[model samples]
Every structure is written in C-alpha cells, then in structure tokens.
Target chain A: MKLKCPTCGREYDEPVQRCECGEPVEFKLFEGEPYIAKTVWERFYDFWPVEPAMELSLGEGDTPLVKSRIGRELGVRLYLKNETANPTWSFKDRGTFLAVSYAVKAGYGAVGTVSTGNMAASVAAYAARAGLKAKILVSESASDEKLKAVGVYGADVIRVKGDYGRLYFESLKLGEKLGVYFINSDNPFRVEGYKGIAFEIAEEITPDYVLIPTSSGGLFRGIAKGFIELRESGLIEEIPTLVAVQAEGCSPICRAFSEGKERIGRFENPKTIAKAIANPYPPSGNAVLKLLREFGWKCLSVSDEEILEAQRKLAGEGIFVQPASATGVAALEKLVEGGGIEEGAKIVSILTGSGLKTLATAGQGNARECPLEGLENCVSF
Target chain B: MKLKCPTCGREYDEPVQRCECGEPVEFKLFEGEPYIAKTVWERFYDFWPVEPAMELSLGEGDTPLVKSRIGRELGVRLYLKNETANPTWSFKDRGTFLAVSYAVKAGYGAVGTVSTGNMAASVAAYAARAGLKAKILVSESASDEKLKAVGVYGADVIRVKGDYGRLYFESLKLGEKLGVYFINSDNPFRVEGYKGIAFEIAEEITPDYVLIPTSSGGLFRGIAKGFIELRESGLIEEIPTLVAVQAEGCSPICRAFSEGKERIGRFENPKTIAKAIANPYPPSGNAVLKLLREFGWKCLSVSDEEILEAQRKLAGEGIFVQPASATGVAALEKLVEGGGIEEGAKIVSILTGSGLKTLATAGQGNARECPLEGLENCVSF
Candidate 1:
C-alpha cells in the first residue's frame, strides 16, 4: 500500500509528512479489489484494503438501511443507515476496528485518540478487543452519557479541563512524541474504514444521495472514497452526491461552502443539542470542502429546532438517535424545500449513535410509572 | 403443522377453546417439527436459523447478536444477544412475527396484544409490516418511553383508563369480538418464535446455561425447545439446564420452583425495576412450573438494586439495555457469588430491550449539556 496525494496523485511511502509534491498525502491501496479471508468479514470486504497481515475482524459491518416511513410523510424517501448496528453501537467502530487492527499489526503497543462520544467508546472497545492499551482524551464537560460509555470500555480516559478545540492537535503531537499510534478521528486508516458505509449503501440499494451528519469530516470523506472505489471497481456506474449535514451552531464546512471559500476559519461560539459533532474546527474541514468543490456537491445546516424535530420523527419511527445523528434527517427537510432532492431520489441519512447514550441534553423521553398494585387501572379485570 | 395435546397427543386444527381431550391443548407438534415457514418466512434464510421456513413472515428472526464487552470485568464472558436488535427493539418481535403471520394467513385483518412494552411494540411493528391493523392495550401508567416506542409503529394504542391487569384479558375478549387476532404474549406460536433465541445461542456457542429474564414463560419455553430440538436432531448430545431469572417483585415461577410446587399459584403485588418481566400472573406460569420440575431447572430473582447494577455494568460495556433485560445479569451475579461460574461453562444472557427505548427507568448514563454558549465550559480551546 502507498499514500497518494489527492491533489497531484504523487505517491509516497507514508502520509505522516507533507508529500514530495508539497501537498499532504493521503493513504492509498495496492490497486486491486480487496478480498476477505472469509465472507464473515461482511459487505465492507470490498471497500477496505483487505491486508493479509491485518489481524482483521468480522463483527462490525453491514448495518441495516431501514426505510423511514414516518419521514416520508414529510416528503422524501428517507432511509436511516442504522450504523448503531455496528459492534459498539456506533459507526465509529468501523473506523476504529480497522485503525486499531492496523495499529496493532504495525507493532504499536499503545493507541490513543481525542473524541467526544462515539469515537471514544468505539476506539476503547476495539482497542480492548485487540488487546492493545487504549487512551482517550476528552473535555471534562463532555456528556456524562458519552463519558460513561467510553469508560465502560475500559479505556484510560483523561478529561482535559479546558476547551477541546485545540486538544486535537495537542494529542496528535503528544501521541507522536510518546511513540503511540494516534488513530485521529481523521486518520487515513480510520477514514478508510468509514468507506464501508458507502459500499454497504451501494450493495443494499443505489442511493441517489447520502446525507452524512458531519463532525470531523472523516465519515463524509470515507463515504466519498467508498464510492470512488466502487466506480473504480466497476460496481456502480455513477456516484451519489454526498450531502454533509451539520449543526448551524458549528458548521465550518457549511460556512465555507456557502461563502465559496476554499478554507474555513475555526467556528466560534458553537452551540446546539448535537454536542457529539459540535467541533468548531473540524479536522477534515479542508478535505470535505475539497469534496464538495470536486463533486459540485452542496452542504446544509439545520437549526436546533429542526434537529429536535428530526429526532422526534426518528423516535416516532422506533429509532431513538442522538442529536448529531438527527442532523442528517433535519438537513433533508432543507433539501426538500430547496428542491435539491428530486422527487424520485433515494436518500439515506446516517444515524450515528444510540439515543440511550444522550438523553440529558436531547431531553428525556416521557416516563410514566404506575405501581403494580394499580395494574387494573389501565386494564379490565 | 399440527397442534397436539401434550397429555393425550390429540391434534387440534385451531388453538381456540380446548383440545378434544378437554385439556388446554398446548401447540405441540403431534408429529414432525411444527414448521419454520410459519415464522421467519424468507428473511429466516439470512441469519443462522435452526429450521427456517419457506413462506410466511412479518420479518421476524435474525436479530443481531452484538459482540458487546459489557460486564467483561466481573471475570464474566458476557455476550448480549441484543434482542433489541429487532425492528421493535425487543425479542418479542420473534414471537409476534410468527403469531401475526399466522393471523394474517388465517385472514385476520387486525391484530391485538396486551403488553406493557416489548410485545406491544413487536406486534405493532410486525402488524404494520404485514399491512394489518394493530390494537395494543397497555397500562396507562406503563413507562411513556415504552408506550411511545409501541405507538409509533402506527398501532392503535389503547391505554385502558382502568386496571392494567384487566386490560390483558380485556384486549383478548375485545379482539375476539372484533375478529382481531389477539397475539397473546405466550401464545404457542409466539413461543415458537422465541425458539429462534436458542437457535442464535447455538449458532454462537453451546452455553452452559442460558439465563432468560422470564415473564410469561414463553421466552423460557422457547429457549428450552431450541436446545431440546438440537439434542433430538443429534446435533448436540446434551442439553444445558435453562435458568429462569425473574424480578423479585413478581416471581411466581421462582416461588413455585423454590417451594417445589407442581403448579404455580398467582404471584401478588409484584414490583420491580424489571417491569418487562415483572408479571404477577403470567399466563404460562403453570407450564413454566412444569418445565422446571421435569428438567430439574432452577429459578432465581434479583432486587431492583441488583438489576440497576447489572444495567450499569452492561452500559459500561457498551450495550444499553432495559432493567427487565438486566435482571438475568443481576441473577448471574448471585450465581457467580464466591466467583464460581463453573469453569469453562458458557453462559448466555438474553438482553430483551434497548436501554435507549426505556431511558425513563435506566441509569440515565450521565448526559451533560454543553449549556448553550456554554461550550467553553465543556471544551478546551
């Protein structure tokens, strides 16, 4: 495998440094269809690098893409790629599983990352499964629900007592200095695993457009790469336009896309129910901005009210997802109004984390308690 | 498939009334394996099914057996068969799928059920899938979280303005009068659907003991049948003793097993955190009692605190489950007292509902808010 500059196609042995062509290099494949040792590896087998020395896994792929009937009442063929079906109940497992396995194979004893919710839990679980020491850094104020989820995976969790905006770069440097493999949320291998989402969507049904709830841009970039690989493999004749959805509170990509700017300054004063993806300065902001420009794709942001409405619509359909995930659905409403989605377009919105992990900020669902002695009060004896 | 009386071996075409011998004819196969075609339909072919069918299904069976590391710390090999992976986020989908399929095949236009949670949602979702109307009779005081989950499937949820205990029977009589197929919680075919759980366990591993959070005896009976069928088919040589775990508040089977009673008497004033299975008068109470005696099985109960502990343990492991589902793990702790889990003995505990669906009663898992412009408070800049 080799790293290739997306801008210049110049190959490099490593992506750790700027490319010889002066552009940041990205991870590359060996130029062949990926193969799985067993079909148990699932639909993602064709999308990932399929390394022979890879201490690969079979537990986290092929999530269910359920058609959203209730969302249709709002006028769209909405489908929720139930990514919570992954091993760790979050799509982060896909990236973390691949990244951790790679890290382990690369002779790394310790792996670390900076995350908010799903990523922390995902890396922790996959790291534990791979028998590697795992470390996670998060803002101390991260939701107790997410922190508890992360800690439960037995990861060494450190809560930084400051804003997490700059912690990402700090962790990267610290990991490198400590000889630790930092599977940054946007690490090439981790993002490579994200491609499986696209492969799965294609295998299940040809989606007209994919609504990705973007935070760090790794998931969106991965989905785009997955489609490119598909077209490269002749699996699909056309690529679906990927729409990256974000909270209006912290949407650098949306701002850049709207202003027709090639780069996004760090967003200030981020706010929303979607604390999961409230990264004011997304790591893959440039990469995703490039994707939108390269594909002529559009970006959309949903208000807090709209996100809440989307969450309610999803729960009404029996899918309780957190705010960040609901952003994709919320953006669909915008797309419909803007005439961005055709009447017949098949749309899929990714639901990122399980709702159980974030009830405090999203508002708790109704709770009714009647003592057992009072059972007859609601029935006939 | 033929229904035969367990006592006389007489067959009955319909499960209505009693057998020709005048005993309540349990739906036993008079001859061969009843039929898989009547249960999972074709989706049965996707996942590993014991005896999958050709036709007839409302999309039941094939729940994801998530590889969650929940409770790996108790030196326990924990595997959550996330029955919540079902469409309705509960294991009840297995049974309701079968019962409702038969109901539709029997030409019923509407389906009715009496459940405080899972079964209600399962029947409603499957009914929607099958294009049949569904009427769910639940306690007015049933957790609003559960009611919303069930009601969202487009089922007509009737919160009887009276006693919940009576609603169970009331729905049945009302369904009969309206020609609605009452998919009783423990209906024989519903039990048939539950057999899939055992099939899944066998697919995963031969558990030394399968811990079931028992309610109306259907889940318990189905698991036992799976093991028994596997043994009969020469697929396995020995059957593991099934363990029934019940909430201390409503443990009629546990009470009977402890008392060595040939039959179960009604349990009164049942109360516990595990509301899904806290049944004071389970319809299959006697049948479960008989199985316990015939198989030398055992029953155990856990307090609300124990269930809460189990729930927290599982959440840490990344599998958020309801208190009812956690009861089995709670009982397992007691069984593992003094650190004794029968060396090399595999124990499989069924987690029946998504903790996200019942967040009202769950530990809440620590969800803190970013506090509007309070981002700086939670993050490091």
Candidate 2:
C-alpha cells in the first residue's frame, strides 16, 4: 500500500500525513471484496493498508446502528451509528487503535498526539493497552478535570504552554527524530481505520445519506473513501450521499464550499458550544471540500442552539450524545425542513461521543424538591 | 412462569418482589432451549419469564467479555465483562431495560425508581425511550450535577426529603396506587434482566469463578440463578464459584457470611469511596446469603484503598472502571493472596460501570508542564 497526495499526486511507500506540496495525503485504495466473516476485523482484514495489532483492540468497532425515532418524525428512515460505545467514549478510538497498532509494529517505543479532548484520550488508552509509552501533548488552557481521563491511562501528559498550532508540526518533526510516532489529527493510518465505519454501515444498510460531524474532516474523508473503495471492489453498487456537518461558528470547509473557493482559510475566534467540532482551520478541510464538490454533496453548518436542541432530541430517544456529535442530527433537521432530503430516504447521523463526558451541557433543570410529609401530593400520574 | 418464594414454597402468577411470607421471590425456572438467534433477546427469549417489549430496546445487551492483562500479572486467566459499554454506561442498563419493558407492556403510564446513581439514569433513559413518564425519586442529599444525565432524559426527578429507608418501601406502595410501577433496586423483573450477564458469560467461556460487585445483592442473586437455570437446562455441567464482592466499609453480607450467620444486619455509619456499592442494608442480603451457603460460594470485602488501586490497575489495561466496579479485582487479589483460588483458574470479574461517570475518583494527577521553547528536552524514550 502507498500514501498518495490528493493535490500534488505525489506517492510515498512510507506512512506520511502530508506531501512536500503541503497537501494532506491518503492511502491508495485497497481494492478487494471484504473478507466474509463474523467479526468486523475478519470481514475487513484485507481492506486496511496495514495489518492491525488485533490483540490490542478494546472491542471498539461494530457499534450498533440503532434506528432512531426522530427518523420517523422527520419523514426519513433514520439510523444512528452509535459511536459513543467505543472504548474511549469517542469515534477517535477507531483511528487511534490502528495508529497505535502501526506504532507498535514499527518498533516505535512511544506514540504522541496533540489533543486535549477525544483524540488525546484515545491515543493514551490504545497506547497503554499496547504497552507503548504515550506522550499526550495538550494546550495549557485545557482543564485539569478534562485531562483526568487521559492521565488515568498512565500516559505521559505534557502541558505544552505556547501556541499549540506550531507544536502540531514541530512535534511531528521532533517525534520522528525521537522514535515517537506522532498521530495528530488526519494521520494516514488513522484515516485508514475510520474506513471500518463506512464498511460496517454499508453492511447493515445501504444508506441513501450519511451525515458526518466534521472537525478536522478526517472522519468525513475516511467515510467517503470507504464507500469509494467498496464501490471499486464491486462490494457496493452505489455510494451514499455523504454530508459534512459542521458548527456554524467554525466552518472553514462549509464556508469555502459555499463561496466556491478551491482552498479553505482559517476562521477567526470560533465560539460554539460544540467545541469538539470547532476546528477553525481543519487539517483535512481541502480534502473534505474536494469530495463535497466532486460528489455534489452538501456541506452544511448548524447554529449552536440547533445543536443543543438536537442533543436534547437524541436524549429523548435514550441516547445522550455530546453537542458536537449532535451536529449531524441538527443538519438532518435542516435538510428535512428545506426539503433537501426526500421522504422515506434512508438517513444515518453519526453520534460521535457520549454525553457522560459533557454532563455540564445537559442543562440545569434541578429536581423538584418534595418535602417528606407531603410527598404523596407530588405522586401523581 | 410463576413467581416462587425461596423460603415458604408459595407461588404466584402476578409479578411480585416478595411472597406473603415476606421472603424475596424469583421466577420459576423456564425449561426450554434458548431461542437460537442473532440478538441476545432472541437467543434467550425462552429464559425471560415475560415476553419482552422488544420495541423498547436501546441495544443494551451483548456487551463484550474482554480478557484482562491484570489477569496475567495475578497468575490467573481473567476476563472482564465490560458492562460500561451498556447504553447508559453501567450494568444497571441491563436491568433497567427489562424493568422498563415490563412497565410499558403492563400498560403503566408511568414508572418510578428510588436511586441517585446508575439505576436512576438507566431507568430514566429507558422509560423515556419506551415513551413512559419516569418518576425518579432521589434522596434530598443527591447533587443536581450528578442528576443531569437522568434529568436530560425528561424524567421527573423528585428530591424527597425523608428517611430514605422508609421511602423505599413507601414509594412501591404509593407508586402502585398512582399507576406508577416502582422498580426499586431489587425489582424481580430487574433481577430477571441481570440473568443475561451470566448467560452471556457462559456462552463465551466457562470459568472457575465469577466475581460480582454486590450492592443491593440483586445482581448477585440474578447471576447465581442464571447459572442454576442453565445447569438445570443441561446447558452446562459445572457452575462457576460465585463471589459476592463488597466494599469493606459497608459490607453487611460479608460480615454475616464471615461469621457464618444466617441473616445480615444493617451496617451503621458506612463510609467508602465506592459509594455506589456501599449498601449498609442491602434489601436482597438474605437472598444472597442463602445462595452463598447453598452453593458454598464466597462472600468477601475489600478496602477502599484496594478498590482505588484495582481501579488504577484496570486503567493501565485501558479499562477505565469506577471504584465500585473494581471491587471484583480487589477481592481476586485478596483471594489469590489467601490461596483460595487455584493456579491457572479462569476467573471473570464484572467491571460494572465506566470510570467516566465518576471522574472525581480518577484523582487530580496533573500533567507535567512543558515550555514551548525546550519541548525537545521532554521528548525522551
């Protein structure tokens, strides 16, 4: 397998995130039918570019594609790819698990990632499970409470006090020199692993639409590539209409697409409650934008209020997802209202992470206090 | 299936927790091969006393049984039933899903549960999903922040200021009057739901021992009965030695078992970091005691310190479980030290809930601060 630059078309035999032209690269598609088997790994063994260190898996994939009640309400048969059930409570585990596996196989002593949220926790956990030293570099602004989950995995968490923007690139250079594999957002192997999500969803249902919550855009691109490869392999007849959903506050990809720009520019001062998907200048924005144009698929952004309402609606369906994960649901509602999606269309919204991690956003509707003496008065149907 | 009293041999067709003899009753063993099908519900349909209202399911069962790395360090082949993967992030989802199903099928417009922890959240989520109003009666001492997940599910959370002990019984009686089926901790249907755990474990690997973190002891009795019914059905020849693990600070069942007492007494002034399992007066204590004696199974206690250490150890293995869930591991170490467990014995510990729910207990182990300029100094093997 080879890594090929999307823009420059430069090819590298070795794993590389970006080409010399400063364009993000991806694996040259693995052309083969999925291995017919029980488990996700066995079924998709030949599809991955590198052989996964399967022994290190925390039962990450094959999350339930539950049918949503909201689908009926929206006049579309909706399914939620419940990715919160992943080991580290996020979709990042699918990527991190594969990245850590490659790091272990290459005899790398340590792995590092620049993240304070889901990715950091994912890298820390999978690395710990694989018995590899993990250095999780986070911005100084990250709260101690938020870092607790990452630190608990016994990873070497370093609070880098400066512009983390520079550190993302610097760490990649320094990590290679220090025998540490830096799997920052949009890493080649990480993107390869996310293909499993697309494969798994296709196996369950041939969705007419797949709405993905876009941040760094790795998830969107990976899913798109997954379907592309499946169609190429004669495993799937047609690819789903992939929709990139982003927060309006920080939607560089959506803005670039809307303006018919070839490349994306950074947004200033992103202020969204959906912090998880608030990437001002996503590393894979250009790649995601390219797919959006090539397929004539939509790149939509929803307001923070819309995301919160979507989160609430999901909670009503017995799923408590983070505000960022609800971006897809919010986008679906918009598409329904605008008649962008036809009635009876099979739609799926990816719920990326669990709300347990963000309980503060669950709202402050305190329990009604009922005095012991007159508690009977409060006990009404 | 009939509800049979364990003590007086009285039987009833209607759903009931206790017999007229004031002893906890259980579903009489259903004699039939498990429904051979894809999902756990279909596979174990015959085992369930009541036909489940399948429409209310939120993909609760079929949790992964992961092999533990700590098992190797402890010289035992150990498996962890990762119940944290449940819909609501706890094993309580298994029982709550069943209890809520029963409530919905019984034509109850509303359901109530007395809990401030995992059960409250599980019941609230399932009830909402089942389209039934949920009345969660939590103690006045319960924090609002902790109830956010439950509240988000649209449950009517009522903080009752009174003796919680008396309220538990009163709510059951009052709930029936108000057409609200109260599913307090040891509800018979809830116990029946827990049988799935044992059935699942047996389906994967037959072990020499199965450790469960005991709170109200419903989980313990349910698992015990599961194995008993399986054996009666000729599904297995040997039943694993069931171990009831509890926090040392509040272990009424452990105290009684250690003293060879027939009944358990209330443990006063209970204190433990594993507050989720620190039940001073577990309602199903006598029932659990009877099973322990009947099967010659073990009942043990571990200190809060041990639980924390075990929790930390699990984190190292990439499983972030709550302190209470770590009780099984803590007890295993003690049993291994005391030469109670034989070498090469296959053991399974139930990691009941996710550590994400109790992030406070994960402690404040802050990361090492690194200045941006000399970050290369921090990049060491």
Candidate 3:
C-alpha cells in the first residue's frame, strides 16, 4: 500500500509522515476483506501502510450490530455498534488495540496517549496486556474519579498543568524523545483500527447516513476509510453519507463545513458537556475536511443542553452514554429540529463511549435512602 | 411445569406467584430442551417465556458473554457475562422483562417496584417498552442520581418519606389495591427471567462456579434454577456451585450460614458503600438461605473497601460496575485470599450493572477546568 496526498495527489513508497506536496498522507485502499489474514505481525499481511510494528490481534474485527428499541422513539432506525463492549469500554480500544499492536511490534519501549476517558483507559490497558510501558498524559482538571479509573490499569499517569489542547501536542514531542509511541490523537495507525467499526456497521445494514462524534477526527477518518474499503471490495454498493458531529462550543469542523472551506482553523473558547469531542484543534482537521468535501458530507454542532438531553434520552432507553457520545444523538436532534434529516431515513449513530466514564458531568447522583426505621413516612407514587 | 414447595409439598397452578406453602416455589426443571418461548412478535423465534398477552420485551434477553483478558492476569480463565450491559444495564432486565410481560398480560395498566439500582431502571424502561406504566417507589434519600436514571425511563418516581427498607413490602400492599402488578422483590415469575443469565452462562461455558451479587437473592435463586433446569434436560452432568456474595454490613445470608441455620435474621445496622447490597432485611433471604443449605453452596461477606477495590479491578479491565455489582469480585478476593477458591478454578463473576449509575458513591467529578487562556495557572494532576 502507498500513501496519497489529498491535496496534490502525490504518492509515497511508504506511508509517509508528509507528502512532497507538504500535505499529510493517508493510506490508499484498493480493497479490503471481511476475513482475517496473517497476524498484524505479518507486514507480510495485506493491511494499511501506516508505519508501525505489527501487533497481533485476536480477530477484534466483528462487533455486534444492535437494533435498538430506543431509536424507534427518537424517530430513527438507531443502531448501536456497542464499541464500549470492546476489549476496552470505548471505540478508542479499536484504534488503540491496533496502534499498540503495531507500536509493540515496531519495538517501541512504551505506549502513550493524551486522554482520561476511553482512550487513556484503552491505551493503558492494551499496553499493560502487551507488557509494554504506558505513559498517559491527563489534565489537572481531569476528575479523580476518572483518574482512579485509569490508575487501576497500572499506567504511569502524568497529570500536566496546562491547556489540555496544548498538552496533546506536547505529549507527542515529549514522547518521541522518551521512546514512548503516542498511539493516539493523530496516529494514522489508530485510524486504521477504527475501520473495524465501519466494517461491523456495513455488515449488518446499509444505512442512508452514519453520524460520528468528531474529536481529533481520527475516528471520522477511520470510519470513512472502512466504508471506502468495503465499497472497493464490492461488499457494499455505496458509502453512507458520513456526518461528523462536533460540540458547538468547539466546532472547527462545523465552522469549516459551513463556510465550504477546505481547511479547519483552530477552535477557541470550546466548551461543551461532550468533553470527548471537545478538541479545540484536531490535527486531522484538514484530512477530515477533504474527506467531507469529497463526499458532500455534513458537519453539525449541538449545544450542551442538547447533548445532556440526548444523554438523558439514551439513558431513558437504558443506554447510558457519556456527554461526548451523546453528540451523535444531539446532531440527530438538530437535524430533526431543522428538518434536515428526512423522516424514516435509515440512520446509524455511533455511541463512541460509555457514560460510566464521565458520570461527574451529570452532577452528583440522586440516589436517596431513608433510615430503616422511617418506613411509615413513605408516600404514594 | 408445576412447583412443589419443599417444606409443605404445596403446588401452584401458575408459576407467576409464590406457592401457597409460603415458600417461594422454584421451577420444576422438566424433561425437555432447556427452551423458553420468545415474544419477539414474529421476529421473536427463540426466546425465554412470556405468557400470552404479556409481551413485555425491550429486547432484553440474549446478552453477550465475552471472555476476559483481565481474568488471565489472575491465572484463571474468566468470563464476564455483562448483565450490566443490558438495556437497563443489569441482569435484572432478564427478570424484569418477564415480570413486566406477565403484568401486561394480566391486564395491568401499571407495574410497580421499590428499587435502588437495576430493578428500578429495568422496571421503568421495560414498563415503558411494554406500553405499561411504571410506578417506582424509593425513599426520599434514594440517590438523586438513581432516581434520575429511573426517572429518565419515564417511570413515575415516587419518593416515599419513610424507611427505605420497609418500602419494598409497602409497595406490594399498595400495588394490590391499585390493581397494579407489583413485581415483588422475589416474584416467582421474575425468578424465571433471571434464569436466562444461567442459560446464557451454560451455553457459553459450563462454569465450575457462578458468583452472583446477592441482595434480595432473586438473582441467585433464578440462576440456581436455570442450572437445575439444564441438569434435568441432561444438557449438563452437574450444576455449578452457586456462590452468593453480600456486603459485610448487611450479610444476613452469611450470618445464617455461619450459624448453620436455614433462615436469616435481619441485620441491624447496614453500613456499607455497597448500598445496593446493604439490604439489612432481604425478602428473598430465607429462600436463598434454604438453597445454600440444600445445595451446600457458600455465601461470603466482603467489606465496602474491598468491594470498591474489586470494582476498581474490574474497571481497570475496562468494566465499570455499580458498587453493588462489585460485591462478587470482593467475595472472589476473599475466597482466593481465604484459600477457598482453588488455583486454576474457572470462575465467572457477574458485574450486575453499569458503574455510571452510581458515580456519586465514588466521590467523582472533583476537578474543574479553566479556559486555555488560563493555561499558566492550570492545576497539576
């Protein structure tokens, strides 16, 4: 496989860090199979040309395609691929697992990431499982609750004092010098693993559109790539219109999309309950913008209130998702309110992470109790 | 199939309610394939059972049973049948689905319950799904979080002002007058649904032992009966040992077992972080107590700190479980620590519900973030 620059159509022998055209390169997919091949260790196997050591996987390709009853109430054919049910509790596991495998095989001494939710947890766990050192960069504002969550994985958590946005980029520079392969934010290999989610989605039902919560745009890129591979493989006739949902408080993609611009500028004053999708400036912004333009895709944004409402709606239906995860549903709601999405349009929303990872944002719990002796004061429902 | 009470030999015409003998009648495992009819309404071909007209299904059954990489760390093959992964995020859905089905079939306009965690969410959601009303009773002190969780399910959240313990029995009396079907703590029919978890476990692997978090004891009893049914069908040679785990603060079963008694007297002060298992007086206590003696099973009580540690361990492995759900792991630690669980024992620990449902207990959401402009003053993690 070779790398192609979206800007100038320049190709490279290896998946290059940057194209001769001065644009970032991505793997070019001719065709993809639903079947597993030589383990990830086999660069011998046909896979994306993302440069990394091949880490072996246990066929984490096929996740379940759940037909949710809750989606019916929301007026859509809602399907949850249940990425949280993965080896780790979020879709990042898909990317992290693959990235870690490659990084390990590439002989990286340590694996690292900048996150506290699903990605941090996922990277720490997979690195632990693979017997590699894990260095996680988290924000000082990251909750103790989430800290304990990642801490349990035995990863060396580094709580930095600075803008999380800057910390993300800083980690890569620091990690490169420290021999810790940052398997996250913009690792092209991580995007490759995300393709599995799309493959799984394509397997069950072809939808008119697929909504993905966009953070650093790795998942959006991966899912789009997965569908592309499926189409090239002749498995599916056409790609689902991929929509990227960004938090309104931090919507560089939406801003770029609205302006019909080819590139995304950094977002400032980003704020939203969907923290996972609250990237002020995603590194894959240009790559994502190109893909969106190529396919006539839409980028949408939603408010914190809408995200919370969606979260409540999903929880009402018994699927608790973090605020960021609710972005897909929130975008759907925006489409509904704007009358953009046609009724009965077959839509698939990716609940990227479980709400359990961010229970704090929901506020202090309301579980109540009375003294055992206070039984008589009970009232009617 | 008919149920015969072991103490009085009294039989029941229908398995929906308790036996006239006053013993919660157990299912008589008949000679047949361990099959329960589904109510998918044409889409439902294979299922557990639903009495005609009782089509209470929210796509609750047929949960996934995935093997655990975390278990390998302990030198034992472990599988987590995430009942917590259900619609209401608990195995209680298995039983609630059935109970609500029967309630709907019996021409009940509303179903009711007094619950802290899974049951409240399950009954509320399934009730809504079944086109029936859910009236959930809880003490004023019930965590505002859980109330909101069940409240999101659109259940009528009845905040009673009395002792939470007696609310369970009180709800039953009120249910009778209102012509509503109260899915009692140990409704015989509810137990039938819980059997589905056992069936799932049996299908995946004949586990050497099944550890269930014991509270009202409905789940423990149902699982035991499922294994019994399997044995009767000659599907398995023996039934796995049914191990029940309780929080040390409210361990009536262990207290009874320790005294070699068949019935449990209520505990006085139930102080445990595992509020779900801190049921000083569990209604199904006597029934589970009887089973423990007859089946020679063991009941272990664990401290709240231990439960929290176990919860962390599971989360470290990408599982977020309610504090109550972690009691099983806490018991496992005690079993292993006490030399009760032998090496290489293939163990299955049931994580009953999503931890997101109870984050307040963990003192989460402690950190706050500032705008990027405040980066220089950012707090250190």
Give the alpha-carbon lDDT of every model. Answer: 0.72, 0.87, 0.71
- Candidate 1 lDDT score at position A118: 79
TM-score of chain A of each: 0.84, 0.88, 0.80
List RMSD in Å for every model shown.
14.3, 13.7, 14.7
Rank by lDDT (best first): 2, 1, 3
The superposed Cα distance between candidate 2 and the true structure at residue B370, in angstroms, equals 1.8
Docking class of 2: acceptable
Q: B117-225 in candidate 3: lDDT tens per residue?
A: 7788778777766667777777676667566566665677666665676777766776787777888668887888777787767766778878899988888888898
Error of 1 at A200 (Å): 2.0
The candidate that wins on TM-score is 2
lDDT of 1 at A301: 96
Lowest lDDT sum, 10 consecutive residues, model 3 chain B, at B33-42
lDDT of 1 by residue, A1-381 (tens): 577888888887654567777888878756632333322244345556644223334256556667667445555677788876555567887788778777877888778888767788788766766667777777766666556666655567766766567677767776666667888879988898888888767766788888999989999999999899889889899998889999999899999899999998899899888987888888899999999999988799999999988887776555667788889988886787777566656888988876656655544323234343443342221
lDDT of 1 by residue, B255-367 (tens): 98898787788888877878778888888888888888888777888999889888776655546678899887888767666354665456688888776555545433343
- What DockQ results for candidate 2? 0.39
Clashing pairs in 2: none
TM-score of each: 0.73, 0.89, 0.77
